[model samples]
Target: MSELKNSPWITCFLRPQELLLLLMLRWAIAYMEDPAFPHLGDSSQPLPRACPWRCSCPRDDTVDCAGLGLSVFPDNITKAARHLSLQNNQLQELPYNELSRLSGLRTLDLHSNLISSEGLPDEAFESLTQLEHFYVAHNKLSVAPQFLPPSLRVADLAANEVVEIFPLTFGEKPELRSVYLHDNRLNNTGLPPNTFLGSEAITTLSLSSNQLSYLPPSLPSSLERLHLQNNLISKVPRGALSLQTRLRELYLQHNQLTDSGLDATTFSKLSSLEYLDLSHNQLTTVPEGLPENLTILHLGRNCIRQVEAVRLHRARGLRYLLLQHNELGTSALPAGTLRPLRALHTLHLYGNRLERVPPALPRHLKALVMPHNRVAVLGERDLVSARALAELNLAYNRLASERVHPGAFRRLRALRSLDLAGNQLSRLPEGLPPSLRSLKLQRNQLRALEPELLAGLKKLRELSLAHNRLRVGDIEPGTWHELQALQVLDLSHNELSFVPPDLPEALEELHLQANRISHVGPEAFLSTPHLRALFLRANRLHMTSIAAEAFLGLVHLRVVDTAENPEQVLVQLPPKNKGALSPKG
Candidate 1:
């Protein structure tokens, strides 16, 4: 045939079977235009339908599939998914047509799955009519999930086991705005009244850790942050938030609220309330129609003994007044009762029973946490009008360094932290405020340290004489040279048998743990070169009494604790190219 098609052994065996059938018909037209190649009836496939191969189409409309232990629901998802993250999967059920062809789904993050409201199907999300932000938070939902999707706007059922919230379950969701039912087990007859009647675009309403004693008078006057904290809410019935007059933040803290279940005209109709957490409630008194544009008033652990200046005369823009652990003493605040709080700046009367130090306060008071009171004297007018006092926690009071009166913190010249830890101080309390930078005299009865007891404290940086009775000749020689901004030096449970030489070269943390330190002088931390934490735990050294240049020039020594010392005391430090000490246990 045409001379056997110009015969060269039939052109090398039939043109190698026609070049292997034209490379198998061009790889079957690129495997039918690979839209992840499975659909064989290719009607002009250009490649767009893929997405669910253990999900992550980063953009042709997002399908994240978080924590893929996905129990089900990832059946080739790409119907042009508009943000669909099945978060922390093991997703039990959502099958009412399982995302019914994702009608252009908009943000559906099934958070921490195991979805249960009897396995979600009251028309499970009714074919998501362009759903808007629906995170099913930590699921196993007991109720609150009805037809939903009137194009819902942010409905996170937080830590769910949602013990009922049915009335229209967000009543005709008028584009609902932020409703997180927090840690659910919701009580008070499981929320009924108009359960958010016609939610006029709600603005953040988290019903916190529930077992709610009461709070459903149809909230949502466009609520502006109302987290009902850890509830068992012992009554708030007066018009229960009177239509939330644009509430500005009201977290009723660890509730069991008393004072006969509060009704100070229900927070005086929250005139745009500004942050009010009635802390651990059982209130003895202090809840009177508050909200004169209140600015932060957390009444700590209540039983508030007395603070009546007409209950803070209409809170004139009060600035942070947390009355800590109540039962306030020493005639419980009577003189001018905090002088009408002129924009008071932070005054937490710590674990109250105050014997003194709370007169007139707030002259722009900057942090005055009155620690475990019964104040036994600290004269100089006890912080004379707090000259903008910068943190002064009178720790476990009953002060005793001769009852501390000499210049008692000289008008607190903006004192920077001075907590006389568990007091009864045996010394060192004179003048003090050289703008003191943290000096907590731990478990006192200080046995001595005298360089005029830390002369003028050159901006001392954290020096807690741990469980004091410090001894080794009671530290007198250059007693840590004007503490050159000493960085953390707590001589733990002191009776120091040694190690105290010059010390402060900007010493960074040296807590001699339960000390009886049996000698370690190789210049004992020689001028502490930025020494990084060296806590000699329960000492009595013996490894030839430690002197491998005893941690020489500490080159930023990183944590060294010679554990409970004498096991023949192997102190061994000098390694990190001759320094960076690491033996911390």
Candidate 2:
């Protein structure tokens, strides 16, 4: 012991208190050297502490206390947290001077909470100078915050009871880019004139689903996308959108806009505009002076009676045009009205009073939906220019099979989906497009699918013939043999006494409900090995009539709806066959 004490390194045995202090000093030095350690003793930065009890520290700079039912903020939150999420919680208020300690916080999500106007004190967000994103949507705040951090880039207060926004709420933040205040109660009186005048960097704004009766003229010039749908807006003042040259998208659907309410030059200055939706209004004619760069326009569900060709002459780059549910007739659209839209791809004119297809359809049209019209004939030249058409929906039209020209669709090599349901067709249309992948013939008059009708449709995937008078003999043995890729077959509500034979080998879903089928043979589905869903409900299927080997080869079958039959089939099945039967109605 005397020799050890005499050594240089081990001078002597010190007291316990002094030795403990020396060990702590060594640990403090190592802690300070660590690059991940948060600096201590900085008055401006909070000291690092242990993670809160009910919270999680997924990363060194993130704390998540979401959906914890925390009415009061958790304690011991580290000051180094940069992303704190307390959404979907019962937190009604934040403690004063508590959140101000997180000086490095960049994003705070408190959405779906009970934070009211009084609960969110101004100081709660006043100290967060570095905060860039703040979300408090789906809350009970009746008014917006009077002040926000200047560094905020996005503020989402949607689905709140906010009826008023202070003048300085969003005007002072120069760096603010996006503000979502949709589904609020703000009206014209509640919004000041200079609400968004100072935020020059603002690009996206949403004020949809509000009670505003007119367009707000206080929008920032840098806005790129603006959503104002589902409002009481009836008129758009001239130059309301003229200065928004950089704006690309404008949604004004579900409003009370009329022909007289809009100015002739309302949309002439939006040179960069690409999308404009003015559907569900009271317009009697197509709006004039549309933007030249507009690509997609929605004017459906209106009182439009005519489409002036000269008004759309400048929209040469239009790709999609919707004019459904209007009062347009065959003469409303003049000749050569749509020839200028060279880039047009889709045109919808359904639910109209047209007696025939519109003249001078665009040559590059890909989809034409004209269902629920008064057309009685499919003329030869009706679709001659639509060679690039891929989809044609003429359902619920007053057309008969005899009125359709034999070679009406012969040149359409790109046609893939055809809907001729709810027509007076007695048989399948001859010379149907071979590239067809879907054919709907339900709610029609006749029966008997000719073998040659679908002989070339090798790529057909869906065929619906429900609510027809097709019998067992109507569907021949090779009716579906050529459809090598067919996967869905709906023959429900038909006059079939038995299941049709020779189904496609790749059939996966078979709907034969509400038929006159009385018995199921053992080889009913022996050819379809890939069948997964079989619907045989509301038929004449009985427990004893269905052969025991009906589902022998169906290894991958998951659903077998046999309800509404004469007897319970699933209950009578043996214990070993229970897994194969799922009674889904």
Give the Cα lDDT of each candidate. 0.82, 0.88
Choose the strongest candidate by TM-score: 2
For model 1, how does the per-residue alpha-carbon lDDT over 307-394 read when each residue is reduced to its tens digit?
Answer: 8988889997888899999999998897778878878888899988888897777678788888888999878776787688888888
* Cα lDDT tens digits for candidate 2, 78-173: 888999999999988887678888878999999999999999887767778899999999999999989888888999999999999987789878
Please report how far candidate 2 places residue 214 from its true position, in Å: 1.1
Candidate 1 collision pairs: none
Residue 463 local lDDT, model 2 = 94
RMSD to the true structure for each prediction, in A, is 16.6, 5.2
Shift in Å, residue 10, candidate 2: 21
